[model samples]
Target: MTRQSISITAPNDHWLKAQVENEEYASKSEVVNDLIRKARAQQDEIEWIRAKLIKAEQSGFTDESPAEILTAFKEEARRNGDL
Candidate 1:
């Protein structure tokens, strides 16, 4: 991977240092990498929720039961060899 020097604000730099020291991250790079990964994951989750909302709107679907959602997720996991 290509490494580039990017400037960060003082507050963010301090936060990164503290995260590295307190969060058991191996280094500042690891802390930054974790932050990036988490942010991307959260973004993907938001996109998925948005898509679900759009589909629900199109179908005029009502709210689903929690148990149904869990069962569906378990079934999907099994189908994907996650179980």
Candidate 2:
């Protein structure tokens, strides 16, 4: 795989190195990779939630009982095998 060099300042570098040591990351690159993956996962979740909300709004969904809403969500999740 191709790699690129990134410059970090002292405190940020120190924090990253400390995290690497404390978390037992194999190297700084591993820590950075994990961070990137975690951030991407978070972004994906946000985007999914936003899309769901927009669809719900567009569908004119009304306020419903928490249990009913949850049941619908669980059914959808199970249908998609994502629960």
Best by lDDT: 2
Q: Write the per-residue lDDT of candidate 2 for residues 50-83, one digit (tens) a residue.
A: 6666576567676654455556766886799765
Poorest stretch of ten by lDDT in candidate 2: 62-71
- In candidate 2, residue 62 scores what lDDT? 62
Task: Give me the displacement of residue 38 in model 2, in angstroms.
Answer: 0.7
lDDT of 1 by residue, 1-83 (tens): 66867899999999888887796787888887888898998678657756665666567565765455556656885799754
Give the Cα error of residue 56 in candidate 1, in Å.
0.4
Poorly placed runs, candidate 2 (over 4 Å): 63-83
Query: Which pairs, if any, clash in model 1?
Result: none
> Which consecutive 10 residues in model 1 have the weakest lDDT in total?
65-74
Deviation from native of the Cα of residue 61 in model 1, angstroms: 2.4
